[model samples]
Target: MAGHSKWANIKRQKAVVDAKRGKTFTQLSRAIILAARNGVPDPSGNFQLRTAIEKAKAAGIPNDNIERAIAKGAGTFSGDNHSLEEIRYEGYGPCGVAILIEALTDNRNRTAADLRVAFSKNGGNLGETGCVSWMFDQKGVCIVQGVVDEDQLLEASLEGGAESYEMTEEETAEVVTEVANLEILNQTLKDKGFQVTDAELRWIPSNNVEVTDSDQARSLLKLIDTLESLDDVQNVTSNFDMSEQLLSVSVV
Candidate 1:
């Protein structure tokens, strides 16, 4: 796989671009609403809802808006004919990096049309199912940061039955696991007094594609930037790690 640092950099850039396009808020709300719909509206009983709510709060979404969204999702209150569905898309970016796009979309028709445009404009081809998914594996990822040392955090994660722990720094770590071990692992880390920044199921690459030349990297990022700019696209995952030099290229 492309190194974690490279992927982290790509994630960072995607966040910035998503925010600028005013797409992040919509995507976050969809996630919040979806989380509420599937699980109980209360975050206490619903871990996904809790994660979505926290993300909304971080984005500065107001309390009332959040509550209303939850209500709508739970079918207690509503305005639009909103039903959430999960969509997975496969595509290839520059340098042939396998890309997977996941979204919680209300309007599949609109989302697909927009995504197709994005793919074509960005030099990517949105493929049929199973084109790129095999390159990845579904796993739970818990990122621990802000206040826990690696040793302490590792101790907590290991004790919690976490499959593995990745030390990003002295104070930050990543706990990875199989689907079954997710909750127990996250709870273990949290129970051990570690600040769990994020705990969610994600698709991790079995192996990563590499982009060495600056031009190739820039081209690849262009595809990512465009895909993420769509209002319906939530999380865009790729096999290439982002480079600082590649990030310097302005996406227009």
Candidate 2:
């Protein structure tokens, strides 16, 4: 999962920018609403809703906004009839890298057009559904930062039924667990005095496509950034790897 760590690092950086632009709250709100709409509004009774709320709280989202989103999604608010649809798109980016996009949009056509344009402008093309999705596996990922002890985190993760874990050079511990155990593992880590930076269900690639060329790597990153900037897009996952040098130089 070499590419996974690199992508995670880049995402961490982009998240800061997103938060600065006030887009983080909007995205978190959508996630909460979708989670609530699919399951119980009470986080304690809904695993997905609980995870969404935890992530929103970690991101410093206001409690009132979160509550309002949950109420709106649960159909408790009058005149709140907005219907949201979840869609997945598969594609190939530069260097034959397989890409998966998860979007929540009310208008599928507009989102599709925006994604297609972004792909075309960045030397990529959207593919048929399931084209690249089969190359990924869904798993729960929890990232903890801020001076965490790797050994302690590993021990806690093991006790919490985590599948595996690794400490990145940036002093972040990424723990992988089954989708059903995400909340447990996250709570376990938090109880162990680890500050969880991010935790959610994610699609992890089975293998990585190595992009040795700097230009190709740059284009791939740009394509992903553009796609993620779209309001409808929620998450973008790809199977691409590059040297740390290239990653540093390619940051836009």
- Best of the candidates, lDDT: 2
TM-score of each candidate? 0.87, 0.92
How well does candidate 2 match the true structure, expressed as C-alpha RMSD?
Answer: 2.0
RMSD of each: 2.8, 2.0
Each model's lDDT comes to 0.76, 0.85
lDDT of 2 by residue, 1-252 (tens): 376477767687767666444666777889999999999899999878887898788788889989998998898877876788899999999988999999988899999999999999999999999999999999998888864466787788898899998777567777899998998998898898888877888998888899889888889889988888888888899888777778878875
List ranges where model 2 is wrong by over 4 Å: 19-22, 58-60, 146-148
lDDT of 1 at 187: 87
Query: How does candidate 2 fare on TM-score?
Result: 0.92
Clashing pairs in 1: 1-208, 6-242
User: Which of the numbered candidates is closest to the native, going by highest TM-score?
Assistant: 2
* Collision count for each candidate, in order: 2, 0
